[model samples]
Target: MTPEDHGTEALSGWGRTMRRVCEVRRPDFDGSLLDAVLGAPRLTVRGAGKSYGDAALPVNGVGAVLDLTAFDRIVSFDEGNGVVVVEGGAVLKDVIDQTLPIGWKLPVVPGTERITIGGAIASDVHGKNHPGAGSFGHHVLWIALLRSDGAIVQLSAIQDADGFWATIGGMGLTGVILRAAIQLQRVDTGWMIRNRRRTRSLDETIAAMRAGGTRQELDPERHVVAWLDAHTHGASLGRGIVDEYYAASTLDLPGAVAPFPETRSPGSRRRRSLPGPGVVTGATIAAASAARWHLSRSANSQLVTMRSALCPLDRADGWPAAFGRSGLVQYQFAVPPNEVGTIHEVLAYLGTHGLTPALATLKNLGLGTAGPLSFPIPGWTLAVDLPARLLRPGIMHPIDKLVAGAGGRVYLAKDAVTDPELFPLMYPRWPAWRRTRHRLDPAGRWTSGLAERLGLLS
Candidate 1:
C-alpha cells in the first residue's frame, strides 16, 4: 500500500448543482484498487457518477476517489436460474442489451439505464413496479465487498447479514463494492401492454393508483406510474395521467421481440442547449404541461416497447444539460398511505410558490427492504425536477418539515440540499445503518459528501 496522490479534478452530481474538487484514481488493475483502499486516509468509491446529489463526491468537497469505470464487466450468466454476475461498475444499459435479447431483464430498475450496478445497490433504486417487485436491493443475491482493513469479503442476507443489508443502501459508505450477483426477471418479449388513464384531480389520481396494484392482483408484477402536470393549480392541482402495464405474455404484438433499443454511444448525439436562463419558466411549463396532458389520451390498452415504457426520457439527448450550466434539482420523497396528504401539501406549496417542475412522476411503493437506509416504504412517492435557477435559498425547508412530520423521508439519491438536522427525523433507522457501517469500517475510511452532510459517517 502506498500513499500516492492522483491528479485532482472537479466533479458534480447529475443535477450539476453540487460541485467539488477531489483527487481521483482510475485504477484499471484490481491490485491497484486494493492498494488505494488500504493506503488512502479518507476515501469514497465512485461509480457512473449518476447520483443527482453528492453521494459519489468526497467528504467536505475534498478527498480521494476510486473511479471504477474501467472495472466494468459482465462476469457470467446462468440461463437456468436467470442469475447474472456483474462487476460493480457495469452499466445497466449494457446489461439490458446483453440479457434482454435472451428473454431476461433486471427485476427492478430506476428511471435511467445509464447508472452502474454499484449505484443501483447503493441507492436501492425503485421503479414503477415497486408496488410489486420492490427495489434493486431485493434482487441482489450476493456481493463482494472490499473493506477498509483491505480484506475482500463475500456478503449475503445469510452471510454477514448486517454488512450485506447495510451496504445495500448505505450510499457506498460501508465499503467499496467490487461485484455483485443479481436475479433477472423473465420476459417473453420486449413489448409491454400499457393501460393508461387521465385523472381529473389529485384525489382521482390517488384513488386510481390505490385501486390498481401495490397489493394482491391477478398480475402482481404489473407496473404502475403517474405523470403529473405541475403547472395546474386549485381544482386541477395534481391532475395527470396514470398508467399501468405488464409485459406482453404473447408474441403477437408488433416488434414484440425488437432488438434492444440501441443506447446512445458517448458523444454520438448533439444536445440542443436551452437558449436562455429562463427558458424553462412558469409560462413555458404551463403550456408544455397542458399540451402533454391533452396529448396523453389513447386506447385503454396499447402495446409499447419496454424501453419506451420504462425509460421514455432517454429519447431526449442531454436533457439535463438543457437546463443550462446551473443544471436541475430533482426532489423525490415517499410517504405512507395514511400520510398521502403530504403529497397534496407539497404540490400546493409548489403551486403557491410558482415553482413549476419540468417533469413530475408519482408511484405507489410496496413494502420497503430490510436495509435500514433503503428509501421506499409501502406508500406514495413523488419525484419532480426543478431547475436550480428557479429555486430560492431555504425553499425546500418547509417541504422537508412537512415530509418528516408525515413520517416520510426524501430519497437521498436525488437529494442535494436536505437539511442535516432533519435527516434523522425522516429516517429513524439511521442509527442502525450507522452501527453497521461503523462495524464494517471502524476507521471511517469510506465517506462521501452526502454522508458527511447527513451525519452518516461515524
Candidate 2:
C-alpha cells in the first residue's frame, strides 16, 4: 500500500500555540492503508484538528500523527431510516452540504462544520442545540474502532457498552475510530427563524436563555445562548445579546422530508481577517459587543439558513489567527444551575486580572451524557477565548477554584490549561474511564498530548 508520507513536519491543532515536529502519515481510502498505520510503533489519529486544544495534537513523547483527511468518504446514506454511514474522516461540512439538500441535517450540528466525524466522536462534541440534542455522540448509532492490536471492533450500547461509552469522549485513546453510523435530522429548507435581543445584566441574560430554551421535540431548534461582553463590569457584568432560533413558519415551510427546493445556505459575510493578539484586545471586544447589541435591533425574527443559525462564528475565516503569536486558549467550563454564581465569579476574575476575553459565550446544557468522558452536564456552560499571554497561572487558579468548589467540570476538548491534580475532581469517572482505556489499549498505544498532561496514560 502506498502512503503520502510528509516526513517530520511541524504539527499543531487549531490553536496553533503548541507546535511539534513529527512524522506525519496520510492514509488512502483503500482498506490496507489503515492497518499499516495501526502497526506503527506509536501513532494518534487527527481529523481537521478543529479541536481548540491539544486533544488531537501529538507532541513530546508522542508517535506519528495520522492526518486522516484523505479517508473522508460518505459511504452510504439511508434516508429511509435516516441513518448515514460515513468514513471517520468525513468532514461535517461535506456531510451537511450533501445531506441538507436531500432534507436531512446532522442531529447535533457543532459551531463549525469543519469538524470530522472521528474528531466529533473522540471529543463527544456538543452543539448550540445540545440542551435537547444532547451531543454528537447521542445520535451516533455505531462505530467501527480499530484497536491497537489490529482488531476491528464494532461497538454500540448493546453490542459493546463498555467500549462504546469509553470511546465516545475517550479522546481517541481507546482506539482509532474508522467509521460510524449516525442518525440525521430531517429538515425542509435548512432554514430557521431567529429571535435576537439585547440583555443588560447577568440575571437578564439567564432569564432570556431560560425563556428561549423551550424545546419543540428531539431537536433543540430553540437554541438559546448569550454572546457576552467580557470587558464589562459592575451593573453590566454579563451584558450581551441573546439569540434564539426556531423552525421557520409554514408559509415557506418545506415539510421535514420534502426536498430542499432552494439553495443549501449562504455563508456569513463577517470580516475574514483581523490583526493578531493585540489587535483583538479588551477594548476592541467591548466595542464589538456593543455594536452587535445595537445591530441586534435590526436582527430580530429574521429567517436564516442552518449554517447561519448553527455556526455564525465560522462565517469568518482565520479568526483565531487574529490571536497572533500569543495563540488562543479557550477556557470552557460548566457549573450547575444553582452555582451560577461561579459563572459570575469567573467573569469577574477575568476582569480583575485586566484580561478581556475576545469572545465570551454562555449556553445551558442538558442532563449529563451517557459517556463518562462527555463534557456536558445539566448546568450553565461558559466559554471564553483569551490571548495566550492572558492565560497565566493566576488567572486559571482562581477560576479553577471556583468551578471545582461548585462541582463544575471543565471541557477537555476546549481546555489548554488545567492543573492535572484537579482533573479527577472534575471528572469523577476518571477511574472507570481509565480502566476502559486500559482494556482497549493495554500498551496505551492510542494517546495524545492531552492524555499525557491529564495523567491519563500514567
Candidate 3:
C-alpha cells in the first residue's frame, strides 16, 4: 500500500455550538482497536455528533476522537424476544427502518432520528412518552465496553450493576461502548392518532398535561407534548397547544391499490439540512410560534406518522439553518413539582427579553434509572432551543440558578453552556459517578470537551 491516507477536520455537533480541531480516527471493528486508541494520551468517543452541544466535542482541542459511525452493523436479532443486539455505532434510523416493518420500535427516541445507539445509551435520552415509558437506559439490556487498560468486558444491570449504570448515562467517560443489546417496543402500526387542544394560559396547559394523555379518555401510552408561544406573556404567559398521540389502529384504505400500514408517516423518509443560515430573525420566530398555536386547531383532525409526530420541527426540512453556525443552545432542564412555577418565571424572563424561543417543547417526565448522571426525574421537563447569541450571562446564568435551586438538573446531551460549580449541585450523583469513572478508567484516559467543561474529570 502507498500509505494510509488520514485527514484532520474541525467537527461540531448538529447545533454547531462548538467546533474543535482534532484528529479523527475511524478504526475498523477489530480486536486491536482498543489497544490502538488507548495508546493516545487523551481520547473521547463520538457517534453521529447529533447531540447539538459540547457533550460530544472534547475540551482543549487535543487528543483523538474515535468516530464510531463506520461500525454500525446489526449484529443479531431475535425476533421472538423482541430483542436486537447491534454495534454501538449503529444508526437509529436504520434500526427503525428495519424493525418498524416488523412491528417494533425503540422504546425511547429523542427529538431526532439521526442518532447512534451508543450516543443514545450514553445520553440516556427521554422521549415524548417519558411519563409512561421512562428513558433510553431502561430498555438497554447489556453493553460491551472497552477499558483503557485494554480489557474488554460485557456489562449488564444485573451482572455488573455499578459498571452498567456508570456507562448508561456516563457521557462516554466510563469507557468506549463497543456494542449493546437493547429491547425494542412493539407497535401495531406506524401512524399516530393525533389530537390537538388549545390551552389559554400556562396554568391551563399545566393542568391539561397533568391530566395525562388527552381530555378525552385516551391510551395510557399516548405520546403527549406541548408547544409554548414564547411571545405570549402576563395573563397569556402559558398559552400553547397540547398534542396527544397514540399509534393509530391499523386500517385498510378504501382506495388501496397496494397494501399499506394503518399509520403511514411519509416524513421519516425526508432528511434535509440547512442550505444556509437563512432569514431567522426575532420577528420570524415570533411568527412561527404564533403560527403553531393558530395552525393547530382544537379539533382532532390531524393525522401523522410516528416520525412526524415525534419531531415536527425536524420535518420542517432545512429547519436547522434557522439557528445557523452559532448553533442553538438546546437548554433543557427539569424541575420537581414544587418548583413548577420555575417555568412561568423562565418564560416571563424570555418574554421580557423579547427573545422568541424556538422549538419550545414541554413534556411530563418520569423517574430516571440509577445511572448517576441521568437527566430525567419525576417532574415536568422543558426543552427550549434559544438563539446562541442570546445565551449570555444575564439570561443563561439566572435560568441555571433557577433550575439549580429547585434541585433540578440540566441535560448534558443538549447543554452548550452551564456553570461548573452548579454541576455538582445539579447532579448530586456526580460525586459517585466520578468515583465509578475513575474506577473504570483509572488512568483518566477517557475524557471529552463536555467532561472538562462540566468538570466531569474534576
Q: What are the C-alpha RMSDs, in order, of all predicted structures?
A: 2.4, 3.0, 3.1
lDDT of 3 by residue, 160-277 (tens): 8998999989998888888999999787767677778999888888987888633322343578888887777678877888888776655621243222244332353323333354
Give the Cα lDDT of each candidate. Answer: 0.84, 0.79, 0.78
Query: If ranked by TM-score, best first, what sequence of candidates would result?
Result: 1, 2, 3
lDDT of 2 by residue, 1-458 (tens): 44444577876667666777877777775465555565577777788887777887775856878777887999999988789999989889889888877778898877888789998998898877777878888888999988887777999988989899999988888987889999997765666878788888888898887766555235566677789877778988888888878766446553553334454434533232244454777777788877776676626767767677787657645677787766788889998878878988888888888777888899888876678888988878999888886776656876877888899889898888887888888998888988888888865577788888788777
Give me the runs in candidate 3 sitting further than 4 Å from their true place.
1-5, 213-220, 251-278
RMSD (CA, angstroms), candidate 1: 2.4
> Best TM-score goes to which candidate?
1
**Shift of residue 49 alpha carbon in model 2, Å:** 0.7
Task: TM-score for candidate 2, please give it.
Answer: 0.93
lDDT of 1 by residue, 1-458 (tens): 23474788888887777778888888777888888887778897899888988899986645688888877899999998899999999988888989987889998877778889999998999888886788999999999998898888999999998999999988988988899999998888777788889988988888988987644234545888899987887889889999988877665565435544444434324354465563676777889999989988845668777877887656654767778767789999999989878999999888788777888999988889999989999888999999888788889899999999999999998988788889999888889888888889966688888888887764
